[model samples]
Target: MAITSANQLELLQTAEAVAREKMIDPGLVVEAMEESLARAAKSRYGAEMDIRVSIDRKTGKATFTRVRTVVDEEEIENYQAEMTVEQAKQYLEAPEIGDTFVEEIPPVELGRIAAQSAKQVILQKVREAERDRQYEEFKDKAGTIINGLVKREEYGNVIVDIGRGEAVLRRNEKIGRESYRPNDRIRVFIKDVRRETRGPQIFLSRTAPEFMAELFKMEVPEIYDGIIEIKAVARDPGSRAKIAVISYDNSIDPVGACVGMRGSRVQAVVNELQGEKIDIIPWNEDQPTFLVNALQPAEVTKVVLDDEAGKIEVVVPEEQLSLAIGRRGQNVRLASQLTNLDIDIMTEAEESARRQKEFEARTALFQEALDIDEFFAQLLVSEGFANLEEVAYVEIDELLVIDGVDEGTANELQTRAREYLEAAAKAALDAARALGAEDSLIAFEGLTAQMVEALAKDDVKTLEDFATCADWELAGGWTTVDGQRVKDDGVLEPFGVTLEEAQDMVMTARVVLGWVDPEELVAQSEEEAEEGAEEGASEAEA
Candidate 1:
């Protein structure tokens, strides 16, 4: 097409319409048109010549020109692109090297093939602009709820047409029982927005716990207004779910508020999730109480907690075990996830049997180790004394709290406990010394007698061996063994050394063996060197 003055306004109008439909800046569309026309002009006027095209934004008047730089004879690598100083003088007076000259060329009529190429270029640019607009619009919407229409289905994934963009709901992220047909309206959680070569990809999810939380926020005014907070959520998706909530206001009940009057609020969320059962429970600051609430509808008789191991043992009535464990252990599993603790559920009968066995074991230990009668051992065990260390380190007042345990008996028990521990420690120290342990390791200030023996037994008998051991082996950290990272109980586990004590012992051993500080060695070497130099000078003078 020949761009005459009469049709220049038509060209500008067409560029504006394309930019409006594609949601791109009008200026960018015009720039793309200029580039297409420039490529066409190069076909007519030798491709080797430097050519540029500019279309006016207001009138769409096209301008074509050739560009050449004035250079010395030696710098003229391409004669078509560069003109020698003498040749450039013909166009103007005394044209200097490095100066550019623009020669105007009349606009050429585009042929059929050239017109087809220009159309393709404009479409490509428009598609790129559309992708950029979609990314900018949806990037910040991730982690929030979005409403869209089902556009199509690919394999098992659903493509939803969100206004101004399209998003994919992968099969794994969809609720197992949910299905969609084209043009159906759906709400989804914007999981992520990624910029890819093909376009901006928006990933949506219906099964994420956050999606349920956001739905509650929309339905419950208390949650949205910050009067109540959803502390945690656990979902078995389309089957059952649990949410723990706490109220900041004294008059408002978090669980009741979340359930709403006659279950209106929670039922709205449930209907959206296709009849997923939800249990809203009040959250407690105390862990055991929180766990008791998390396992709702199941009565908990007792809870025993091990904080270090992140475990909780819950005992329920025999009739309640099935309910507490749920089908395939679902209830306890969800409770574990909601509280972030490992939950082990058992019956009251089982816990009582285990407790009795433990009491008998402790009674036997006290009778044999302290040389006490069965009655006296029973007395100690009844007072909650489980080991000799507690009896050895506990105050006499603690023992006096027991009936029939007078001051005289308390002193005698403590004396026997001390004597037993001292003898045990002395034997351990002698054994470590006999095992070829270095004196430096044996005398390390922080190592207890038992820790030294444990090291010796493990063949870490030398100063270098102890120094080279990893902090995790000496103290407590994660250690990799056979491609797995496992928590190190510490190399001194056999001796019952605590993690803190093990760390201190490792630091002391390194310091004593001179593995940590090299300044002293450097000083000693310098002193020896100076002394040798003085001795050599004295010998020469003599």
Candidate 2:
């Protein structure tokens, strides 16, 4: 093959054209071309030689050069990359050991195979530059809504062309009822932009709750103006959705503003979502109030919240129960998602029945544990005494406040409560000792007599056993059995020991038995070192 000025100009022009078509920087394309030329030059100049190629931006002229570094005679290991001091002196007036030398070489004319190789190199570099450009363009657009054309469908995923690049709307992220044909325009949320080995993957989603929120933002001026803010959103794609909004301005009605006149604003979003029903509810700082608003169109009779368990029991009218818990529990499910709470919906009748059962059970417990008659137990239960601990710990003044309980009767009740608890504790301790519970285990600060008995029954009776107990064994946790998570009955369950209390008991046992965990010891040493360093700095400042 032969090369002239026209051939060099054509090569530079091809790089510029490819860069413009790929939407990458022209300078990068030229650099890639130079690298390809240098690679081809290596076949003729010897692979070990340090050959480099440069192309003029304006003239499109190509230049090739070889580079060598001057080194001491003893250090001249490679004749290609290093030149001895004696050889360097021939090329320079006074060459030092560290000086570099460059020699210009005539540009090589590519053969058929080398030209194909250079083309492949240029194509690879162009693809990389295009990927980098796509990443930079879409990385900042994550979590925002983007409009695109449906280019094609592969398997269950839709490929969308978003003007500058293409994105994939995966099967899981598409609305159930939504179907698209080629060239059909659609709006989707940019869920993520990830750079993998293949290229930048732009993941699109139509079913995300944020997609609905973004639609509302486009339709409602109040949300865009910052007067009303969306607090939370829950969506059952193509079926139902719920949004909780709060207004910073006291005068603005967030729900009304979102609904718009004749429901125009919300209807626009509904049409975009393929007729998904949306319920706009006002957000409240009070959790119960928010829950009540979330489960709308159904009147709530009562709400019982267990904060520690992160659950809420909502009692509605018997007739409203089905309404509060919509078809397949959709209403309650969406409400739970919106409020970040576990909601259990029940009828008022059910709640009443449950309360009565609890009252009877508590009354029977008092009758058996305190040796009291049914009448006395009923009186105690009516006075809101759920357990013997309340009777034993309450002030005498509090007992006097209950009807039919004079000071004398209160005193006798308190005495019986204390005596019953003491006897129970003594019985548990004797049983634990009989079952081989170590005295050290019984002496642990957080372990109750009941806990000791439970551990003794489980054969975890020694101090070593207690020290070796895993956190999950002491507190309730899930264990994998038959490829499923099964709940393990913790030793402390019967004693109503919290996870923190169980942890403290285990740590106490470990410390008493002089069992040092290496990980714990390392962490302790690091903390001590940090504290010492801070104290030294403080003393110096003083």
Candidate 3:
């Protein structure tokens, strides 16, 4: 094959045809042709020479040229491609060191091997361009719903043709017992799009909670119009699910809108999910109120929430306990997910027994610590005094409010409580010192003697050690191992140190030790506050 006038126009035609077939830019194909021609030209001409080729976009005329650069006499490396500034006078009137001298050259004749090599180069370039096109088209389509046809099954994964590209749906992402064959129509959520060496990978999912939300958005006009919003979603795949929705418009009932005229809207989503039963609940700002709705069909007698711990306890009648817990604890688990809380559901009787047990335990603590009679301990517990610290530091008037207690008795009680607490603190301080704890740690503000002892037991005996500790290390945290939450016990966790408090304490220690700049900390906090305000504004607008 040769670059003759007859085949010149064919190059442009071929580029356009390939571009149309691959849905890529024709300019990319033309550039690929130019590169392939240049590579073949290099093979025919001296390999050391810089042979270049360009194809005219309109005329399709292939022009070949050999380019050489003018370099300093002492800096010349490639003799065929570079020349000294003084030796470059033949190509220019006044050649500079970095000037390029170009001369026209005839196109190379492509033999069988050279033609095959050129074809491979063009194919490789076209493939790269196709991958780039696919990535650009699908990257922003993530977190959306798309319909596709199942192409084939690879191992346990199903490959689907998603219009312009193919996506893989891992088996675990499929609804329970959902099977697909070749050419089966499937709707999937675009979970993610990633660029890799092979090409762009589009991950599809059918079991994602977002998939259900998207389905509702598509089927319900109120949701699509922003009159109602899906606040949260929790799915047990094809078995059961719960969705929380809120209405911005006062007249529009979010639950009624999602449930449709005759359960049509929700049924559409349920049909697509392989008959997954969905419980739609109204969203509320109060977590306990929201959780009560989330548990649905089961009457809750009482709700106790621990905001800091992100946990909730729901008390239901004994008959409703089984329904609230559902089959294998699925109901409560879904409720927990919907509310973003750890839920502990108990029968009314169980809650009563637990309360009684706790009351007994507190009474015993007051009895032993204050050296008071069982009646006095029970009275103290009944008066909301759980520990000696409360009994010791509370106002004398509060103790006077209790029946059969005067000012003298209140003073005596406070005296006993103070003596016991001081004795305990001294013993803990002595124990910490015996374990090699320094005064720097013991004297640190915010840490009690028991906390210092705990830190000493954990081998943290200095202010420096405390400063180097991570907040989670001091406040305790949950770690996910093999999909299970494992408790990480912190030395100060039992002392009721929250993560934020631990962070503040550690940073304070660092500041006291002169290890951190107070000014930088202030600047960082201001920057974070500005960022958070900006994010909140953007979310509100959205």
Pick the TM-score winner.
Answer: 3
lDDT of 3 at 383: 91
Model 2: per-residue Cα lDDT over 1-542, one tens digit each: 54568777886788778888999999889988888899899987888888999899888888899989999898788899789888988888899989989999988888999988887888888899999999999999999999999999999899999999889999988888578999999999999999988999999998999999999999999998888999999998999999999998999899999999999999999999989999999999999999999999789998888664456999999999889999988899799889878788889788899889999998998998888899889888998888888999999898898888888998998999999888888999999999999888888777778888989998989889988987768777555676333567788865566566677777767867778675786798799999999999998896
Error of 1 at 392 (Å): 4.3
Give model 2's TM-score versus the native structure.
Answer: 0.83
- Reference-based lDDT, each prediction: 0.87, 0.88, 0.93
In order of TM-score, best first, we have 3, 2, 1
lDDT (C-alpha) at residue 229 in model 2: 95
Estimate, for each residue in 296-412, the C-alpha lDDT of model 3 and write its tens digit.
989999999987766689999999999999998889879988988888899889999998999999999888888989999999999988778899899899999999999999999
Residues 1-542, model 1: lDDT tens digits: 98789888877998999999888899888888888888888888878788888889877899999999999899788877789989988886879999889989999799999999988988888888889988998999999999999999999999999989789999988987688999999999999999999999999999999999999999999999989999999998888999999999999999999999999999999999989999998999999999999998899999989775566999999999999999877888789879988788889999989888998899998988799988989889988898899999998999999988899988998999999889988998999988877777777666777788888888988777887776667655555576334566667765555556665566556767667665765686699999999999997885
Instruction: Identify the superior model by lDDT, candidate 1 or candidate 2.
Output: 2
Top lDDT prediction, candidate number: 3
TM-score, structure 3 vs. true: 0.95
- lDDT comparing candidate 3 with the true structure: 0.93
Q: Which stretches of candidate 2 lie over 4 Å from their true place?
A: 1-4, 70-78, 83-99, 404-412, 422-542
